[model samples]
Target: MEKWVVALLAMSAYLVFAFIVGVLAGRGRSFWSVSEYTVADRGLGLVLMWFLMGGTVFSAFAFLGGPGWAYSKGAASFYILAYTCLGLLPWYLIGPKVARIGARKNFYTMGEFLGDRYDSRAIQVLVGVISVLAFIQYLTLQIKGMAYVFNVLTEDAIPIWLGALISYGIVIVYVATSGVRGAAWSDVLQGILMLLVAWVVGYTVVYSFHDGVADMFRGIEASRPGFLTVGAEGSGMSPMSYTTILLVSVIGFIMWPHLFTKSFTTTEKKIKQTVLVYPLFAIFLVPILFIGFAAVGVVDPAQLTGPDTILPHLVTHEMGASGIVYGLIGAGALAAAMSSADAITHGGSVSFGRDIIQPLKPDLPERTQIWIMRLSVIAIGTVAYYLSIFGAAGLVQLLVGAYGSIVQFAPAVYGALWWRRGTSTGVIAGLVAGIAVNYYFQLVQPATPLDINAGILGLIVNVVLFVGMSMVTNPAGSRADEYIKA
Candidate 1:
């Protein structure tokens, strides 16, 4: 069979599997209820929670961007592993508390929790706007990843836009119908498949290039001297950049809306246990870096159009068009893209429907609100699909800015749970200042005022405003007293 034919078969089979899982998940359930659809009735177990969390975190970045970074930048690629492991560590302490509050308050979205905590509709609106924007940006990246895989693996037999539409259209239908439960179950299957493929491809590339793993490293050391060592000379990234990236990712990881909303889907114990086992997921990515290293001498970085396309190019060229292996790689890449997309699409809809719409229109019926949520999923999915097709150089900047700005939620989140003195004025002022600073640094001036990340700079300003404002402003009187009491 032709390689394109084999690739098409592989992707189609994976989509079929996902659709089946999604349909099955919706069966015999009370799909009409908002709680059931959004949070699976808060009844997810440890096993499902583990895979859901792992699968959500390991997106197209792990499969494609991880190795590409390793191949192109040397030791800097280890940032993938460092950030993944460290990012979830603090969640152990924070996850259960958020879960407890969510369960007690019947909160289904992060915006709900923040709004109720602050007793301010404006704060909720601000969070809702940012969540929707960030999630849409995130969805665009996932669509692009899927488009790239389909286009390249099929040798351009399928156009990029059509490929993205087909893949994500399935996600929209399933998520609108089945909700979070459908996303979790499909993630389990995808998570397992992608992990297996990462190991197989990583080892295969090393064995093909050199005698063994040790021999491959030996070759690297001889040619690129210190390439295997940390802080290697001639490495494209500085140690400060490496350390900052790791710190930012780790601290900012759980702040993501999709990850934050998952807290409402499971028990506190299950959430903690899932976090404990989540670090193992980081191990699956180490081999992907090996694939990039294997391509170091064989492939020229300049010849490659972009870092994200390197992995697909390697599999199609190096794997010799073997039907089954090519099929497996395609399946794995599809899993990576689809798993992340479902969660993002779902989270974006929930934020839009609950945080922005329902609050403004208190008279909206539950059934109508549910319909709005479903419609928002399709609308957001279509917008992202079109954006991905056009493509943008600013995507990287947009994502970094979003992540950095979103992490400003850290103070609000942590303050709500532990600190009694935190006030509404403090939280709102801090968030605005942080996001404004982050935006200015990212867009207005490409360089940070002092070589720090824009988000990091924003965070510093956020802290000052938060502490200073709280000292001067009074709380919301009876309303604030009642919320804190609750």
Candidate 2:
């Protein structure tokens, strides 16, 4: 068999194993209950929570986009590391509170908590809409990443559309059957495999090129002067842009529905302990960056067709006919894609079932809601599969832009937690204004009026509207007050 075929088979085998493990993980449970399906009865321990959270965050973007950015834009790529570290930092404090409240209230979705806190179904619907949209976009990136890996490794023998369908189809099946429990268990396996692959790739690049880390930097300096530093000539991004991107990601990371919903799955103490170990998860990314740096000076950026393809190109070129390395890389890439996709597919289903469907039909049976959620997994997975096939060139940028709207939730969420005066009117108005501003800025101009991210600009306007409108409106009544204190 061809090396590509062997690699593809290895990846397929790993995915099959993951599905088996996922199915087995939830074996004795009654998935008919929303609590069992959505949040695993809110009883996860630290180890599973750590891997699930870390694996979801360190996605295909981390493995694929991190290196791609570093290879193409130089120091600006450090934004990946910066944003990741800073993103999880806030969770140490915020997560425990969310977990405590969510567990107490039996909140399976973030929308449920937000709505209950504000005593407004409108807030629930709004959060649900945003969560679904952002989850779809996030799923699109993972699907695209999987397609790119398959296409590159197979040299287009397997078409991108078919590749996406095959991989994402498996995700839908597993997630539909097992929900968050499956996603978490599969993530543990994927996380370990991908980490090992990252180290191997890093070492291979260094060894093959006959260069240590110091020598690699020296080569980059000689060929691409100031490449180690930000704002060098030929670097595609400005320092200001880099800093703002990092800021946006740091602030926006936990706002993701998949990550936030995980708060509902574990205990408060477990959540805090998970945060303690998450920084160590960030350290696993260093080797992935080293792979990108190794490509510099060795592979000309201009010669590469697209930044996402850089890693695959380097692997195939460097490893030659070594079937084992190729298989390992393919498995790692598939793991990254599968781990992320499963969480998103599961999260989206929960949002649709718990927040959207139940609210529309309050009398619906819990078993029916569970079935609807299972079907939603397939529905959402299919939509994302098609979108990934037809979407833009840079999967990471599209993901950032798509999910950027979630940051608008910061005001509503924080206010619900701390501010007693925040009203439903203010939250609705602010979300609309923020989304409108963010959309206009993204489509009309690449940068905001002041060179900040469009989302940041929108967030400023969102906050102003939220605060301004809250002061103008009547304070949330005794129920809202009680909910906040609860």
Local distance difference test, each candidate: 0.82, 0.82
The residue-by-residue lDDT of candidate 2 on 446-477, one tens digit each, is 65655688888788999999999988998655
lDDT of 1 by residue, 42-87 (tens): 9987777888788776787778787777787778788888887777
TM-score of 1: 0.96
Q: What is the TM-score of each predicted model, taking all chains together?
A: 0.96, 0.96
Off by over 4 Å in 1: 229-232, 394-398, 477-486
Candidate 1: deviation at residue 205, Å? 1.3
